[model samples]
Target chain A: MKIALLGGTGNLGEGLALRWGKLGYEIIVGSRKLEKAEKLASDYLKKVGDASIIGMRNEDAAETCDVAVFTIPWEFAFDTAEMLKRQLAGKVVISPLVPMKKVGDNFVYVRPEEGSAAEKLASVLEESSVVAAYHSIPARRFANLGEEFEWDVPICGDSGAKEVVVDLTEKISGLRALDAGGLSNAHLVESLTPLILNVMKRNKTGELGISFR
Target chain B: MKIALLGGTGNLGEGLALRWGKLGYEIIVGSRKLEKAEKLASDYLKKVGDASIIGMRNEDAAETCDVAVFTIPWEFAFDTAEMLKRQLAGKVVISPLVPMKKVGDNFVYVRPEEGSAAEKLASVLEESSVVAAYHSIPARRFANLGEEFEWDVPICGDSGAKEVVVDLTEKISGLRALDAGGLSNAHLVESLTPLILNVMKRNKTGELGISFR
Candidate 1:
């Protein structure tokens, strides 16, 4: 299947593109700047030594790709989602953005007024199926797809979209996709980012990750 | 000063007991059963070389010690906090418990209706000066006081109590305590636990903790 990564020049977007690219999915890196998109795709191709990945402007990429994932920063997440609504209509829009504030030793997730980031996206993109996944997964982890992760990727969205996302997640190999309830409960899924950071800092565990009890 | 560690038989409680014991603070391991408490203290001495630490029943430990730290599970967090409320009056009660539900490659935070775990503790013990702190720090990190951890500990509560707790945190040698805000905001603080777990699982960084940007 073809997957377009909107704002694919970013840390998270880049990591996902690398992983999905290796899994035999057609990767189209989307960026605000056409040149930036090309640069990201070229860098990824060089890293992977594979030529299946391509790059294009966000609009063109969104129109042609079967599914699109948004890995934009919190400040630009809503606008990015809104702008792509027309192209993303009747299509899947995966959002993994989280709202957070930095404190002394760590960061705290400032809950959005409309509730969690996924809920806000779902509300705005009422016409499209917005699946919120990978909100808690660190970009560094996604960069190394060759390694196996034994933890569950808690996903939340409409049932139909959830099925598609989970199928895509399973395609990555060695990663489990779990139905973590409904879309309204996205706060529970998205708020895990800062908690992970806190645990990493306190334990002094460098490059740390988790496995469920 | 005397410090009581409720559920001191566990990983985190044992770690804290060893660290504080080395710093010259009297340590008391509290458990439901007196025999278990004594065993934990013995184990600490065995692990870290003997110093000064005693074990007792939870209530008696609370009554004897000036400060109390509850390092138990989230399932029993409320009851444990309530049981020790009378003994905790005028003293500080620190909670490091997190509520999490595991899903595929991630863990979603099961947020309490009363907000985060710390907020629940404050509401349950409104008569006491409840300070929510060390919610994100890993127990193993604190277990070895000789190991230096260049990280920050976010703390929030009554002003005087905050200072006292901050002072106590500094005695550990390498930990820096920062004032995050107030007790009402404990939801944000307590929710960090699950987020950390999710990040760790996704990244495959074992025993990972948080660090500020």
Candidate 2:
């Protein structure tokens, strides 16, 4: 299956691209600018030594790929979804956006008016199936290709979309995919990012991730 | 140290009482009625075969014990704090309360007006140090004494009280306590309860606990 990483120039997108590329899935790096996406795709290909990964504009990538994953920051998530509404119809879209604000060296979770980023994205792209996952994994862990990801990725969505996302999650080595209820529970999943960040900050640790046992 | 479990008639309180009582801490089972507290204390003692665990009214327990832990439900938490404010003065108090409401088959985290349960309790008992921990542990895991708790408990509070709670947390076998920033970040910790509950519900699993690595 072809997977498109929307806003794929960031660390999160690059990391996922590398991992998925190594797993033999076709990867398309999507960004607002085609040149930046191409550059990151080139860098990821070099890192993973895979020549099959390609890069394109966000709209074009979403229109062509089977799965479109939003690895963008929370602030731009809704707007990007709105812009790509026409292209993402009938395709599975994933959200890893977490809304948080830094307050005096402490990060606080800011609940969006739509409850969560995933819920908002779902509303914007009414024809598309939106699944929320990968919200809790640290970006650094994703970028470090050598490290095994021993963390649970909780996914929430409608049944059909959720199954697809769960299947995709299991394809990644050392990661477990758990079905964590429906789309409404996305806030609970998104909120974990700041909580893990707080844990990492106070404990003086890096790449903090969670496992449910 | 003499540790008091306020509202000790509940499952969470009973579990902690058994664990700490086994560890040789003086356990006081506190409740609204002294008789109920006494009965639970007797049952606990019988279960653990420890005679030192005692029962008392909530106010008396707070006044006498070194640490007062509010293991009550979120609905009764604020009122109970108000009733015991004078007795809890200058003492270290722990809030494991998670504010959540069940909607349909799933539970959603409802943030209190004061941001989190711990922050609300802190505001009510201004003279006491409020520490929030153990928000994510499942009650069944705690009550089943045979199982070793291989989970990370993230704690948040002022420096002094936080250290005391961390020390107490380490006393439990196979449990690791890590500082999770200050009291302002309590919402992040409290919010994890419902997320775990949702995960358990969707996955058809039990005793789902988190470990950060």
Candidate 3:
């Protein structure tokens, strides 16, 4: 299936694109600027060696893909989702968005009034199937193909899109996808990001991923 | 150190009492009823074997101990903390309380107006050193002496009490203590309890605890 990474030029986007691209999925990297999208797409393609990957403006990519992953920075993601609503309608969308901020020496989850970042994205993309996953994956190490690690990705959503995203996540070696609960429970999964970030930053444990053991 | 477990009649209290009692700390199991406290203390002492473990009323335990752990249910813990405020003044207190509720099939964190359960506890016992830790430990499995497991406990606090709790947590076999910033950041750590509970219940994975690997 065609998968689009909306605002796919960041660390998280790079990780997902590289992992899925190498697995032979048709990966489309979407960005506000087409040139940046194309640049990162080609960079990821070179890293993957041989893969069906391309780059396009967010609107075009959103319209073309069967599935889309919002890998955008949480602050700007809502507006971008709003703009892409028509294009993403009736399609499966993955939300890895974490609304968090650094307060004093720690990172805190800025819970949206809509409950969580995923729920907010779902509200914006009303017709799209929004599934929350991949929140606590340490992107730097995940994007490094040479690094091997075992981590759990807790997923939450209301529809079949959750299963689709879970299957997509498990296709990436060394990652286990767990169905956490439904859309209303998305805040629990979303909060794990800031919790992981604060733990990593305070402990100086350099990009840690979670395991439910 | 004289360590007291306030409202120490639960699975979490049993786990801490057994673990720390074995470590040779003077373990005080406190409850509203002296008989209930004494009964559980004797049970824990039998399990721990030849260790310093005793039982007392919550008031006496708070006044007598150097450090106290609030293993009480979050709903009633505030009033208990208020009642014990004078007794616990100038002592280190650990808040393992999680304010949460099950919404349909999943658990959600009930964020207090004070930010988190730990923060709320801190607000109540203004003179006590409040440290947040052990929210996600699988208490049932933890209390089962035969059940061996590895887990990470992220701690948050504003003073030297954090170090004391960290040292105390790490002393438990198969557990690693991680500093996850200050007391202001405790909500991030507190939310993980419901996150883990939801994941475990929805996935039917039995009881699971977190490990940041």
Candidate 4:
């Protein structure tokens, strides 16, 4: 399937592009900067040996792709998703943003009154199906391509889009995709990040990961 | 004021004992093993020259001190607080525990249904004024005597006992104690740890801290 990663120049964006590109899916690395996006596309192509990868401005990427995934920061998720409303209609738009506030040695999830970043994105893109996935997982670990994903990746969204996200999640080599209810239940899952950080700090272990028993 | 730390041999406990002791508060280092606590007490005496330092087992430490702080793991917070309840009434008991679940190069906060670790303690100790503070801040940053605390420490509790806990917070050099409302709001403050870890992991910054605007 064809996927355009809006704001795909980010750490999480770049990682997802590489991951899916390897699985024979068409990937267009979208950016606000056309030249930068094209350059990243070429760079990723060189690394992954996937010549079909392309680069385009976000609007063009959205228009041309079957689905679009947003890997933007919490602050930009709503605005960016709103801009693509027309183009993203009848298409799946995935958001993996988590609202965070920095505290000493750790961060806390600053919950938006409407709920989590995914819910916020869905609100902005009312015309599109917004599937929330990959908010709690760290992008760096997924980017490594060397590390194993031995845990469940919770996917939550409307019924029509839920299976699509679960399928996307399963495409990753080692990840197990689990249904964590619908999109409204995001706050509970998104809130898990801060709890994990506290455990890592207290245990004094540099390498930390989650496994749902 | 005389303060006893029931688990003073460890990192968080030792740090708190030193911070309070440096401010002319008599400190008692208490542990499961009297010998270890005594060794820790002497070490503190040598470093800061606080003459009133004493070492004892957990119960004895609670019996002799005017106030006590639990600087142990979340699992131990309940049992230890229960054991010290008889000795802690009519005296201040502080808890500083953050619950986290480990994930690869990351951590997530596992907020108890009672809300936070501090709220959990307060529920167990109805007689003792179990005030929740210091759950969000990193102990290592506060452990450095040379460093300055130009940050806010969110202190939450029963309004009647707020002053005493705020006073304890203010005594710790430069920390400004901000009333973070009631214990129910503890989840918002406690949820910061994992979000910080995600930022650290993504940015590759070893030392990161939060500053409220």
Candidate 5:
């Protein structure tokens, strides 16, 4: 199966690209700028030798992939969703978006008008199957292929897209995917980012990924 | 210091009673009916062997303790908080109340009018130091005494009472208390309960307590 990491220049996208690419799934690194996408894809290819990986513009990547992940920052994701709605229609699009902002010394979850970032993306994409997952992952740790850790990834969505994302998530090493419920439940997963960030900041614990015990 | 478990007949209260009673802190088990409170207190005393554990009416317990935990169900805690306002004044109060309800098959966090349950309690008991903690603990497992598990408790409050509660939580064998900013941030911690519940239900993972790793 082919997967596109839309705006794959960031840490989260890089991690997903590397992990999936090594497992022999085609990884398309999408960026607003073609040159930047190509540069990152070449870097990623060096990391995962003998793999199917390529660079494309956002629209081109969205049109080509069987599945896509919105790895963009939440602020810019809606606009990108609007631009690529047609290309990504009927395709499963995973969201790791967390809408959060700094308030004084603490980070707070900025609840979107549509309840959560995933729901908001779904609303904008209309025809795309939007699934929420990966909000709690510490991206830097995940990108390092050697870092062995156990973390639970809670997935929320309305359609069969959730199962596809769940299966895709399990293929990545050291991560377990759980069905948290429908798209309406996405806020619960999104809010966890700021909550974990607050815990890490206050407790002097480096980075935290939640585990169900 | 003396600690009161207001409405102390519940599972949560029983867990706190056992843990604190074993640590030799004076444990006051408070309930609406004096007989019920005394019965449970005696049961706990037998379990702990030699410990300072007693029973009292809610009013007496609130007035008598240095710290008070609102161990009642979230639905009844507000009225109880209103009733014991004067009695609990100038004393530290902990709220493990998670405002959540079942929506279809999923549990959803009901954002209280004052933002979260802790903030709402703070609004009602203006003179009390309201701190939020223990919302994510699996009380049945905690009460077992033999169940060994590592869990992180995120605590939020605006006063020195947070420190007191933090120290108290650390006294429990398997808990690490984290400062999750002020009372306003309590909603972040409160919402985690329903999130975990949804995860547990959909994933069939049984009762889940959170671990920050």
Candidate 6:
């Protein structure tokens, strides 16, 4: 299956592109600028020696991919979705955005007016199947291709769309996909990011990831 | 140190009472009715064959115990704290309450107007040092004394009182305590309950608990 990583110049997008590209899935690195996307995609292709990966503008990438995963910062998340709404219709869209603000040295979750990032995306792109997943995993861990991810990835959305995302999640080795009910529960999942960040900050630990036991 | 389990007739309250009682802490099972508290405490004592556990009214429990853990439902949390305001002063209080509502077979996190359960509890009992912990653990698992708990317990509160709660958390065998920053960040901790519950319900899994690795 083909996957498009929106905002693919960033750490999370780069990580997903590398791992998924290595696993033989066609990866499209989506960005605002075609030049930047092409550069990153070319770099990834050179590293993995895989020519199937390509780079394109966000709109074109969304139009062509089976799944579009948004790894952009919270501020740009909605706008990006809004701009690509025409292309994203009737497609599976994944949101891993966590709305947060830095207070002093710590980060606190800022619940969006729509309750969560995924809910907001669901509202803006009514025609798309929005699934909330991969929000709690640290970008550093996901980007580290050599490291095995042994964490539970809880997915929430409409049943049919959620099954597709779950299948995608399981295809990535060591990621156990869990069905966490429907899209309304995305706030709880998004809230986990700040909690995990706090734990990492206070404990002085590196790359804190969660597992369900 | 003496620990009080307010609303001790409930599953979570009873579980903490059992575990701490067996670990040789003076466990005060507090309830609205002294008789109910006494009955539960007596039952716990009979099972553990220990005389350190006792039962008392909520007011008396808060007054005498070094730390008071509120295991009551979200609706009664603020009122209970407000009613026992005088007794809870100058004591370490722990809140494991998650503000959530069940909507059509799934649970959604309802952020209180005060932001989180800990924040609301702090507002109600301004003199008490409120710490939030133990929110993500399954009540059934904690109640079953035979099963060993292997999970990370993240705690957040003022430095001095948080240390006391952290010390207590680590006293339980197989449980590791990690500092999760200040009490203002407690909402993130409280929010984990509904997320874990959703995963457990949708997957038909038995008693899910979180671990940070």
Which stretches in model 3 have alpha-carbon errors above 4 Å?
none
Give the per-residue lDDT digits (tens) of candidate 5, residues A1-213. Answer: 999999998888989999999999999999999998899999999998988889999999999999999999999999999999999999999999999999898999999999999999999989989999999999888888778889999999999999999999999888999999999999999999999999899889888899989
The interface root mean square deviation of candidate 1 comes to 8.2
Candidate 5 structure quality by residue, lDDT tens digits, B1-213: 999999988778999999999898999999998998899999999988889999999999999999999999999999999999999999999999998999888899999989999999999999999999999999888888788989989999998999999999999998988899999999999999999999989998878898889
User: Any residue pairs clashing in model 3, and if so which?
Assistant: none
Task: List native contact recovery per candidate, as a fraction of 1.
Answer: 0.01, 0.91, 0.96, 0.01, 0.93, 0.96
What TM-score does chain A reach in every model?
Answer: 0.93, 0.97, 0.98, 0.93, 0.98, 0.96
Which lDDT tens digits does candidate 4 get at residues B1-213? 888888877766767777788778888998989999999899877766745687999999988887788877778878988888888877777777778776654466677888788888887777777666776565666666665655546665665676788888787766666665556556755654554444445445553334322
- C-alpha RMSD between model 5 and the true structure: 0.8
TM-score, model 3, chain B versus true chain B: 0.98
Interface RMSD of each: 8.2, 1.0, 1.0, 13.3, 0.7, 0.9
TM-score of each: 0.64, 0.96, 0.98, 0.56, 0.99, 0.95
DockQ of the two-chain complex in candidate 2: 0.83
Model 2 regions lying over 4 Å from their true place: none
- Model 2 per-residue lDDT tens digits across residues B1-213: 999999988777888899999999999999989999999999999999954799999989999999999999989999999999999999999999999999998888888888889999999999999999998777877877887768889899975999999999999887889888899889888888988988888889887879987
Model 6 clashing residue pairs (backbone): none
Q: Which candidate has the highest lDDT of all? A: 5
lDDT of 6 by residue, A1-213 (tens): 889999888778877788789888999999999998899899888877854789999888999998999989989989998999999998999988889988987888888888788999999989999999998777887887777768888888975888999988888787889998788788888888888888888899998779988
Q: Score the docking of each candidate (DockQ).
A: 0.09, 0.83, 0.85, 0.04, 0.90, 0.84
Best-to-worst DockQ order: 5, 3, 6, 2, 1, 4
2 versus 6: better DockQ goes to: 6
Q: Write down the RMSD of all candidates, one decimal each.
A: 7.2, 1.6, 1.2, 11.7, 0.8, 1.7
Q: Total backbone clashes of model 1? A: 28
Q: Candidate 2 chain A: minimum summed lDDT over ten consecutive residues — where?
A: A140-149
2 or 3, greater by lDDT: 3
